[model samples]
Target: MQPTILAALAFLVFGVTVGSVKIVNQGNEALVERLGRYNRKLRPGLNLIVPLMENVVLEESLKERVLDTEPQEAITQDSLAVLVDAVIYWRILELERTFYAVEDIETALKNLVLTALRSQIGMMKLEETYASRGQINQALLQQLDGATATWGVKVTRVEVQQITPSRAMLESLEAQRAAENKRKADVSEAEGTVESIQRIAKALKEQPNSQTVLQYLLAQRYVEANLSLGQSANSKVIFMNPKDLTEGIADFIGGDEPNGGGDGEGPKPT
Candidate 1:
């Protein structure tokens, strides 16, 4: 009877010993407390604790965690309401502080992130908000890192997911941009016209014989004009060489004596 009683006590002790031993997974940490007071943190793998004396409160994951936040409404400096969404990457650095320093790290992190976003958006204009997303993200990460440091949480990065303005505001902005582009296009067209006119004038000034070319061009214009006028039925077409027309006009005006035809010998009768 004594031997059986001793065997039972030994079996109970063995069971208690096995229960006291805890194994932590890789990329994780275990926080142990003695008599409800702060105690040592256990690294990954096998760890032994005193049964009924030391209690393991929580196991913290050291691997990075991704937290995607819901969309939040933020008012810009221009008083325009914009919807902003973001995501944060974080991980716990200190096991003890992660479990004991904060009751709920995720909730606290989300609130902190939202407040930081609001503060950032409030200081920036609508255009700046869109243009400075990178700056905003960096600022948010920095702020979150600072705030969560005490809670043993490290913020790796913060990303802006979406930023949207109201439909009316977007339409107004589009109209404004369109009007500005139209004004620029008109100014460019007018400048191009002026440049073309200046180039033509410069070319004409450089070549004095351009007047003869102009006369040929005028003859072509007359032919085209006559063809167009014939469609009116009340118009008449006249055909004459440009040299003969010039000479006839000179004679009618009693200007110079007529030159000999094709020989350059002496003056001849008209």
Candidate 2:
């Protein structure tokens, strides 16, 4: 009977020793609550706690984590709708505040990020939103860092992933871009034509039989223009008399008051 009681006592002591030992893995932390109240935190490695009275209420990794938010619909200042998404890199600086200050850190962070993203986008035009992604990311980081400081979470980096316009908006933008390109091309072509005419007029003024040469060149240009219109499927062909066109071109190219003439007097017949 005496030997059995000693064995039972030894077994009880072994059980208590095993129960008191707590091994915390690296990069992890645990919060201990004594008798259902806050007590202390356990860092990596072995720790001890009163088995029945103390409890590990929380255990979390201290390493940095990534949170990716889904694309959210946002309206630009121009009333255009776009889908925006982002990625947030963060880590806990004070586990206690992180646990107590916010009900769910990740959820709160996501909502905060999205709210800031929308607000920033709301103040910008559609074109500006696409061009100012860096500005947006910086603004978001600042805003988040300030806001989450109380929660004991450090926002390390923020990245704006995608900003996409809706299908209808994309099509409209493409059409606008094409129209702008066409307008630029037309202006360039018009300038080239004017320059060519100026050069030809200057050259003709220096040559004998200038009037005949100008008339021939004007007729040739008119014929080529007509041929181009005839070849185009969408051209609205306008048939103009060649004589009138030539006369107009000659008057424009050579129209200048005769030397020593009054303003009321026109050019003398060449």
Candidate 3:
């Protein structure tokens, strides 16, 4: 054969051989349309098709994909506005229906997600949204899956990325939290103080000569109060009554009681 004719034949054969087979990679699927109508689905690996009579209508990945949605604003049941955003995880469940069942799957999905988010948020209060993220995510997954089932899509999960309130509302929430914590701390400290006082009273009742110990404790507390006055934010250096301040200290030092019990070295009755 002539060299030019042989080369032409070889080129034609190679083109036809390459066009006859379609390579569908792993984690992917392809849909074949025959005579401009629905046909069979090709899964991962090599697939054969009639090159002249048919073509691949759609190709999609079977692997899970992520969609990061833009931030959306929604009102809570409390009529509070919050900015919400989410991430969606999805996969193509059926290749044939994925192409035929929906015109624009992604747009449909985006809208579906946004609507679901708004609806869910509207059913909850603003304060509940922060703690109920898992509930919101689960609700989104269920709603998305149900809506997209006909489209042959599976919504694996949804994650609420951010749910932020207005700066004023956020500051108010933080202040409320701090106030609640301080109230709880004050109550706890008061309860502890009461408990300690009760314990000390019981000990004093059990001892026959606990007056001297009580005087010493009172003097110590007086000294501590004097020392801490400078540390108090709202404290002023007001002159306190000298008589009231010296009452316990005189008893703690060697001053005799009215009953002349100046010798505080006696063994206490336990």
TM-score of 1: 0.62
Task: Rank the candidate models, highest TM-score first.
Answer: 2, 1, 3
TM-score of each: 0.62, 0.64, 0.59
* Ordering by lDDT: 2, 3, 1
lDDT of 3 by residue, 90-138 (tens): 8888878878888887888888999999999999998899999999999
Best by TM-score: 2
Better of 1 and 2 by lDDT: 2
- Global fold similarity of model 2 (TM-score): 0.64
After superposition on all CA atoms, what RMSD does each candidate show versus the true structure? Answer: 11.3, 7.2, 10.5
Clashes of 1: 0
Clashing pairs in 1: none
Which residue pairs overlap in candidate 3's backbone?
A: none
Residue 257 alpha-carbon offset, candidate 2, angstroms: 34
lDDT of each: 0.82, 0.89, 0.83
Which has the better TM-score: candidate 1, or candidate 3?
1
Q: Could you tell me the C-alpha RMSD of candidate 2 in Å?
A: 7.2
Model 3 has a clash total of 0
Q: Look at candidate 2 and tell me the lDDT of residue 11.
A: 97
